[model samples]
Target: MQNTVTIGKQAEQYAYQLLLQQGLQIIEQNWYCRQGEIDLIAQTNDTLIFIEVRYRTRSDYGNGAESVHYHKRRKIISCARYYIHTHPAVEKCMIRFDVFSMSRDSAGEFSSHWIQDAFQT
Candidate 1:
């Protein structure tokens, strides 16, 4: 696998562990629809969470979380809607959008940040 893909996978695994530690139950990953892909779908305290995962090796451009552009938010929101349509019970549940970003050092150690409700629908 490409280095970036491998790093991303590791970051996702780390993010998943972080979420679980926070008492979130994961429902799905890499959820795809005509609109786009939702990196994660999870539940906590009667709330459904849609997550976006981003990893950056360096901040030369900017932090990974800042990389989520407007178009991407629209796509994620649409995908969340599609997911809700597929699961009507969840449609009525409180929804939150989160972003998890991982910044990696040369040693491959990563510092991850969780930003809840980072964007709105």
Candidate 2:
């Protein structure tokens, strides 16, 4: 069985490709700070997007995106704040939080969903 870390990496990679295909420029991936980690960061036009990538092989507990609870949202938001503080050029850019969920079906095929403006800071 693949570990959680491995699944997370795959999900983030899939999310990155999905975003790129949708015309978002990759600013960074796996950005970390004392606050927490932001899975993927990208830019589209004038918006700075902070993305949270979630993956689930089974739905016994819940879907991937549903796993991002209030505490998780707070951590992502804190990390985003740190990112903006360090990158002054994008400070004035509009900010958006997104959630990308990847799921593996019974046929072993993976599917993904993108939720724009998933939650507010």
Q: lDDT for each of the candidates?
A: 0.89, 0.91
Instruction: In candidate 1, list every pair of residues with a backbone clash.
Output: none
lDDT of 2 by residue, 17-116 (tens): 8899999999999999999899899999899999999998878888888999999999999999999999999999999999998997787667998999
Mind giving the per-residue lDDT tens digits that candidate 1 earns over 4-96?
Answer: 888788888899888999999999988888888988899987899999999987788878789998998988999999999989888779999
Best by TM-score: 2
Clashes of 1: 0
lDDT of 2 at 68: 98
- The alpha-carbon lDDT assigned to residue 7 of candidate 1 equals 75
Off by over 4 Å in 1: none
**Candidate 2 lDDT:** 0.91
User: Best-fitting candidate, measured by lDDT?
Assistant: 2
